[model samples]
Target: MDMEYLKQFSLDGKVALVTGAAYGIGFAIAKAYAKAGAKIAFNCRGEKHMEEALAAYKAEGIEAKGYYCDVTKEDEVQKMVADIEKELGTIDILVNNAGIIKRIPMLEMSAEDFRQVVDIDLNAPFIVSKAVIPGMLKKGHGKIINICSMMSELGRETVSAYAAAKGGLKMLTRNICSEYGNANIQCNGIGPGYIATPQTAPLRTPGHPFNEFILAKTPANRWGTTEDLEGPAIFLASDASNFVNGHILYVDGGILAYIGKQP
Candidate 1:
């Protein structure tokens, strides 16, 4: 392969906006973009989260621009985008990573709770993507990555709202690509598998049933890590994926492909 071919992966001179990137998967992707030479901008709903995220980013030697915004609100999203444009530049890359999940069963899930999940997981991406697309259009190029979940394809118990929202997000990802491909804007998704984050720490204890189940089901026999997602996020954000639009890249440790150990 040509050495120049590998250079296509570099994100130099790009400005990336990763929403709700206070921590977890969003933080990891932002770090990856920074490592690849992209300026990082992230938003959080509260000042507490924003401060924490800023400290974390600073500790890592990444000078990330942090904002306060509730991504689910269209007005807040629009304002945040405008601020980012004024402070940074026209957003060249957008990572719609803000989301919420209500793990109540379908029957027990309240309509209000369901709507909240949909608003954050599905609608917020639509809102934020809409806000940034105009700038992207004027700039003549952009990349939008929706943070989807495996629930986009598979259903599970006690997560009806999450599944519904993710399923909608998957379709929205495709729809954005369909609408904007001609404009040189690529919209795609990253459906992460069960990752070992602090939020999942309780479930990942050694000998925990859920941990064992995940290990047995995955062909890779291990839960995914934030670092595991960094490369894929970078690829989707970089020039290398200019032609790869409307795709959902699952970083699932092969769980989606494997049918589970033979009972």
Candidate 2:
């Protein structure tokens, strides 16, 4: 293998902003970017999470900068971006990893609740992207990776709002690519399927119906881990994916392609 070919995957000197990176999926991606030598900046909406996040990064020997900003609010997002630019230079990679999910049934869910989910999941990406695109354009190249969900393509019970928001996010990713590709901006998405996070540990216990169901539906017969998403996230945020845009790379265990196994 040519050593020069591997350089395309390096993010050295690039500045990356990963929203909602206090923990879980966002944290994993940010850690991966730091490993690839990018300067890391992330946000948390609350003081407690912000403090904890800074500690977590430090534990990893990463000197990550954390900001307290609500992504759904444009003004707060704008300020965060400006601060990041001042501290870390213009952002060359943006991972729109901040989002929320409301698993309420359609009829039972209130419009306000639905709107809140959409605002964070869909609109925050738009707001944050708008804030960073100008900097990216000035830099003459950039990468924006939206953390979409499997719901972007498939729907399940009790997730009406999440599905809608993620579906809209999918289109938003494509639209960003369409609008900014000419300016050397590559906007893409990562759609994770049934990631096994601490929040889902209860559901993943042995003999759990939901766990069994997920395993049956997934061709890999296992849940995805945050580690599983790291490489793909790195690729999308690196020069390796300069030509890859407007695409949702599902880091699923083939759940989207398989029907359930026979009983």
Candidate 3:
């Protein structure tokens, strides 16, 4: 590969803040950024999570800065950003990866449960993004990557609240791009397919109905891995994707494009 082409992907001297990065997909993305030469910073909602994340990063030989911040709380998010700026640097890359979902049917789900989902998934992204944009504007360049879901584009059973929040997130992604693209800030989203993670291990057992359904629906014939998202996350957060704004890169192994085989 041309050195120039590869150089476009380098994130040296950049500071990245990935929310909810204690483990799983968010952790994976943060690791990738660290490997690509960006300074890693992450936030979790509690001290225990922060301690675990710091240990994990240290074990990986990454000097990551961890913070305890509730992304859904605007004041807390602002304070965290200020601290990150003071301790690390202005955030050049912001990954809105903090979110929660309640797998309950719409008719059976309580309004409070629904509100919690939206608050974390949709409103928190807005809060964090708002907090960081001014600094980005002053710096004259920035990347905001929202960790959306397949639910952003499609609905599934027992995930009504999740779907609603993700769907709203998709629009928010585009609107951020519309409002800031001219200012050299690119806001995009990543919609992951069913990824094989510890949280989803039980559902991935062989012969399980949900496992079979996922495999059948995914054209790639398997669930995705955290590593599967690393490259896309890096691209969206790097100079390589400066012009790629307002798009949701569905890293779903063609599940969205396929209609599935006939039974």
**Which candidate number would show the highest lDDT if scored against the true structure?**
3
lDDT of 2 by residue, 160-223 (tens): 9889999999999999999999999999999998999999999999899999999999999999
Worst ten in a row by lDDT for model 3: 43-52
| lDDT to native, each model | 0.94, 0.94, 0.95
Q: Please give the ranking of all candidate structures by lDDT, highest first, separated by commas.
A: 3, 2, 1
State TM-scores per candidate: 0.98, 0.98, 0.99
Root mean square deviation (Cα) for candidate 2 = 0.9
Q: Kindly report which residue pairs in candidate 1 clash with one another.
A: none
Model 3: how far residue 239 lies from native, Å: 0.6
Clashing pairs in 3: none
Give me the overall lDDT of model 2. 0.94
Alpha-carbon runs more than 4 Å astray in model 2: none
Which lDDT tens digits does candidate 1 get at residues 16-115? 9999888999999999999999999999877888889999999999999998888888998899899999998899999999888877888988899999
Q: What is the RMSD of candidate 3?
A: 0.8
- Residue-level lDDT tens digits of model 3 in 35-79: 999999898877887788899999999999988888888899999
